[model samples]
Every structure is written in C-alpha cells, then in structure tokens.
Target: MRLTRRRLCSSAIALYCLFSLYAAYHVFFGRRRQAPATVVRGLRKGAAAARDRHGQAEQPPLEMEEWNPWEGDEKNEQQQRIKNRLQILNKSTKGKTHISVQIWSKAAIGLYLWEHIFEGLLDPTDVTAQWREGKSVVGRTHYSFITGPAVLPGYFTVDVNNVVLVLNGREKAKIFYATQWLLYVQNLVQIKKLEHLAVVLLGNEYCNNEWINPYLKRNGGFVELLFLVYDSPWVNDVDVFQWPLGVATYRNFPVVEVSWSLLHDERPYLCNFLGTVYENSSRQALMDILKQDGHDKLCWVSAREQWQPQETNESLRSYQEALLRSDLTLCPAGMNTECYRIYEACSSGSVPVVEDVMTTGSCGNTSVPRPTPLRLLKAMGAPFIFIQNWEELPAVLEKEKTLILQEKIERRKILLQWYQHFKSELKMKFTNIIESSFLTTNKP
Candidate 1:
C-alpha cells in the first residue's frame, strides 16, 4: 500500500512539469510564430487598400496657397523652396502634361501684343530686334519669335506642334508675305507635321481683312484661331476675336510702370501734339486751332510736314517727354480715327482728346454697321475726350485749364487702372483660349 501511494505522487509531479514546459513555449516561441502571421495579415490588408485606390480615378492636385512678396526674405526663401519641391512633385505626378507653344512674329505691333499678352516680358531679340524666344508671363505656353518669312523655315521644326504667327496683312505687299507664311504652315499641317496654328493679324486701318479668309479655321484652313485688330465685322469672340491695337513697340514705346511722381507731379503743359501734319488732314486743322489764342504756346507742339516711319533718338525722347509732361494729348485723325498716340498717351497717364469721327474705310463707312467706328474703344468704355470736330477743342482745353491738380491725378489713376485691367483681361483670355484648344490635341 505504501509503494502504490509513492508511485501516485511521482506521477502527479511529472504531469505538473509537463504543463509548465507547455506554458513556457506558448509565452516565447508560440508568440514569436503568431507575430509573423499578424504582420502578414496587416501587409495583405494594406495591399488590398492600394489595389482599391488604383482601380478608382486619379485625384486632383492639391490647391496651392497664395504667396505674399512682402514676406521676409528667410520665410520667403523657405516658402519658395517648399513651392519648388511641390511643383517638382506635381510635374512628376502629371508626367509631361504642360503644352509647349511657339510664337512667331515679324511686325513691331507683334512686340506690342507680346508685351501685353505676355505681361510685359521681353527676351533680347536679334540685332534688328525682330526675333526672340522665351517663356511666357503666364500659363504653359512657350513663345519663340521669328523675324518674318525669311526666318520662319529656319525656326519652324517638326517637333513644333503649336504656333502663333503675328502678321501684318493690312496691305498688298505685307499680305503677300503673310500669305506665304500661312501657306508654308498649311502644307506642314496637311502632312500631319503641325498640330495647331493661330494668327494675330494687324488688319487694315479700314478693317479690310478679306485676304485672311483663306487661312481662317472656319473656312477649312489650318489656322485654328484669328486675333484681328481693328473693329472688323468678323469679330465673333469664338475663333475670330478683336485684338486691341496697343502702343507702338516699333518706335520703342516702353511698357510704362506707374510711379508716385507720374501721378502726383503737376504737368507743365496743358496739352501736347508731336506728330506729322498731312497736307489736308484734320491734324493741320488742329494745328491751326492750337495757333489761335496762343494755345500752341500753352501746349508743346512739334509738328512736321513729312511723316517719319522711324523715330530718331532725339525725336523719340522729345515725344515721350511731351507725353509725360502734358495733362492732355491731342490725337487728331490721320488716315484713321484710331492712332498709336491715343494708346501712347494712355500709357503716360495723359488724357487723349481723340477725333471720334469715322475716317473713310470699308469698316468705318456708314453703310457697313451702326457701331463700325471705335466700336472696341467705346465697348471698353474709354475715358477720353472724343469730339466730332476740332471746333470743340477750345471748350475742352478751357475745361482742362479749370481742373485742379487733384482732379488730374484722379483722372490719371482711372486711365492707368483701366489700361492695366484691359491688358490683364486680354492676357487671361488669350491664355485660356490657347490652353483649351491646344491641350486636347496636344502632340507633345
């Protein structure tokens, strides 16, 4: 009986030892084994989530915050670095999404358009200042100006899918060159080498742009868009839009940045007129009117019988100075009612006293349309003194004499503000149009 009781106790001890070993293995080795399984399950769940996201449409880019230039240098630098990093990331994510555009222009007005449309950016052109290449002021468009038909072939390449040709098709000679440029691009398009083409044409002072019909996109031509100057009846704002004849860049008219002095400083002259007087034009009549009552003495009048296409340094300086120092700019009608002087005066914060009567032209003729003359300017609400005849000038100048310094400053501000807004709106419109049209059919 004693031997049997001892055996039972030994058996009980052995069972207790086995249970302890099992618990130790579970606490160490068993937990280690379970950890790997848990990790595998988590990885599998993450992979499933990734696959789900991949199946859905791509998310849009995050909105960028506005940057303040007034911020301190250190903060600005840090912010700029962050912005650059984000831009790089976005570029990587987008994967070559920006559209590259090449602009070609030979005319001086082209430079004017370039200044406004590109927001006053200028890269050095050739020695003649007729050719240039650079990035634009806004949007994804890139511009490369070519000196004209002679340089068009040299600059144009197969890789250049998008193009903007600024041409002066106002006369027979210029129209011929413009036609040659268009035909060359058309042929390229026909062979599927070029994707898109647009034109910023300087239409005739008479609004006679019928020569451009063959190259219009609406007429089954390669040109996708047409930005025509002058108040042409063809302006539809869709494909054919009215482009403002801005300041004369050919004469090196600057993109004037307004200053406190330009606004506050009192102008010495009540009026100014530095231009050619034709044999029998209203300009001569304007001169005659200014001569009466010693108005010419009060005003800065530099009139020449012969018209000069190019301005000498002295003449240009004198002209600019006259504009800067005068409260009013006399803009008598030459061949056309609209002149570069009106815009040039606006740039200098000088009020334009324009001859509003319609000049002889198919566009300005009474039979054509009710608002054929100065339609664009009137539509834009130009704050200028428009007179039917030079007879009204004395009254206008007399009123101008009565205006105080503060009144002139306010008027100047209004003109400058309007001009700035006009340019900005045009820039945005031009950018939007190109992007929308070019992106869908982007070749590169």
Candidate 2:
C-alpha cells in the first residue's frame, strides 16, 4: 500500500509542473500574438456595426482638428500680406492725382467710359477719392461710384477735386437729376472750389437743343472737358466721342478682331438693312425704294415695325454674320444720322451707305455750317457712301455691281486699316487731353 501511494504523488507533481510551464509561455509570447488578432477582430465587429446602423461603411475620423490648431494665425498672416501689397502700390503712386467717377450703373454709356475709355488711362491707385455713400471702392483705385439720384445728394458734401459726372441725356429722370446736380456743381465752380470737372453727356434728343444746349451754354466755362455723343456746332465746346460699335448691345462680342478671311468670302447680298421701320421715317422711305427697284432680292433686308431692346443669341450671331458677308451695310438715320450700325459695319469691313440728310432735329447751328448731316463721319474721313435721298440707291447699286473681287478686297483692307487707326488716334488724343487738362494740372 505505501509503494502505490508514493507513485501516485510523483505522477501528480509532474502533471502540476507541466501545467505551470504552459501557463508561463501563454502569459508572455502567446498573448503578444493573440493581442493583434483580438484587436483586428474588434475592428471588424465595429465596422460591421457601423454598416448596419448607417447602411454604409464609415471612414476612420481624420485628425484635422489636431492639424489646424494654428488656423487663426494662418488667416491673419494672409490678410497682412494683402494689406502690405496694397500699401506698397499706394505708396508708389502717392504723387499721382486722384479721380472720382460718379455715374449711374444702369447707363450703358457709363460702362463704356469706365471700362473701354478709362481702362488704360488710370490705374487702381490713381482713383483714391471716396464718397460718403457708395458701394465698396472699385478696384485698387478706391473710386467710390454713387449710382443713383437717391445717394447723389450725399455727394454734395464730398470733395470734387477731379470728378467725372456721367449723365444719360435721354431719360427724363436722369435729365432732371442731372440738372439739379449741375446746378450744385455750378455753385462750387462759381467759387472756384471745383477746378477739374468733366461731363460725359449721352443720349442727346434728335432735334431738340432746349434740353442740353441751355445747360451747356450756362455751364460751359465751369466744365473743363465735355464728351458728347452727337457733336453740334450749337454746343461748340463739346468734344465728340463717336457712337461706339455693338459694344453696348452684345457686351462680350469681339467687334475689333473680326476674321478678315471670313469677311472676304463671296457675299450673297449687295447690302443689308436689319433695323426697325417707323412710319414717315427714312427707313420706310428706304424700304419703298428697295421694293420699287426689286433691290430686296439683291439685299438682305430684315425689318420689324417695332424696335426690340434685346436680341436672342442666334439673331445676334446672324446679324454679325450678315455684316461680315454683305458688301455694304445700309445705315438710314434713326434719331440721329450717326448710328452704331455705321461703326459696326466698319468693323466687319462692310462699307456703310449712310443717309446723309439731316433728320428734322436741332443738331447744329443752322446759320454757320448749314448743319450738314453726317458731318462727324465726313470729319473722321470715313470711307462711306453718303446719299441725300433713297432715290440714289439704284445708282449706288450699279456702281457696286461693277466692282471686281480684288477691288472689293482692297476696299475692305483700306476700311479696316482706317477704322483701326481712327480708334488708336482717338485713344491717344483722349489720354493726352485728360493728362494735360486734369491730371497734370497743379490747380487745387
């Protein structure tokens, strides 16, 4: 019995030693491998739970919050850089005189004056004048544009060292308000407080001199420069700015860089007239003459009883193409003898056949120059056919039919070259005049 009991005790002690060794290995090496597997399993389970709740696997959240701890500092540094750049530009142009442009935004002419006319003349730093009531200063020049009459009164107290007043002469409201504004500016001029004042007066009434002439005659000396749309001998102090080409109509259209090769293609029509037809108007007379002579078959004539304010994209394109393809563009006088069509046709290398009769309007001094219609075109050396009556259309067509392709091409080149030179010369004169009169002057 003693021997059997001792054998059993030895066997139990060996089993206990084996179990301790296995536990020691598992606590150290085994657990290290199992820990990674356990973590992976947990991640899978979490992702599955997320999918069940959201119907999609969720991405692990990013540490963006940790990365952007210095956000405010970064923004401040960027703003400081912009301020420093503007300050440097301002410092460089410190001695340059500033100009303030006060204009109504709705006026299409105002856009032309600011964008096309003044773009090359003034830098952003050159327009540092401020208005009490205006939208944020435009560009780097800090030009305060007070748009409407409601805020115009606020400009009464504002400084007008060098100012441009843009007025649409056609609108009744603009005329009324402009009269009031001019009266105020006239008072300042009387005291010699306002030295450099320029006016860009647009939309002159066809024959009526009463609206513009009286104001201009009274305030002529007060105004240093006058940019008039339709020049009149009655208003001899005015400087003529020709009716700009389809810029106001199709604002984005490139009227300057027309494809000469495309324009040189064989044209199907001798002339084109795309405009409104009014009763007793010269356009009606032109239609009558065209119909009688069967010239409608030889020309591209599209006329409507009423005038349209805007054209569709397709119609605008068609009109431009017509101008490009036609040999001549008929420009019958509307409210004035000089219309935008004359300039637009010139851009397309289409000779303008203008009706040179002075429409029943008070444009020029009747006594001195006999108010020759289209005097502006004649003065500009425009290569156009001027006719006193629509009866002369058949004779003009006869002459056109005799011209050969090479002759037509030569004419187109000459017209295109002249048009370009005209614009360049005008720009040079405009810049020189402004600099000499307003910017370079030492007057306070």
Best-performing candidate as measured by lDDT: 1
The alpha-carbon lDDT assigned to residue 224 of candidate 1 equals 87
Candidate 2 lDDT by residue in tens digits, 209-239: 3565545534554656666666454445334
TM-score of candidate 1 versus the correct structure, residues matched by position: 0.74
lDDT values of the candidates? 0.79, 0.66
The per-residue C-alpha lDDT of model 2 at residue 4 equals 100
Clash totals in order: 0, 4
Instruction: Provide the lowest-lDDT 10-residue window in model 2.
Output: 123-132
Q: How many backbone clashes does candidate 2 have?
A: 4
Q: Check candidate 2 and list the clashing pairs.
A: 124-141, 127-141, 207-361, 207-362
Per-residue error at 350 for model 2, in Å? 1.1
- The segments of candidate 2 whose C-alpha lies over 4 angstroms from its true place after superposition are 1-106, 113-160, 177-195, 207-222, 237-254, 439-441
Write one digit per residue (lDDT tens) for candidate 1, span 177-212.
888878888888888878899888989988888888
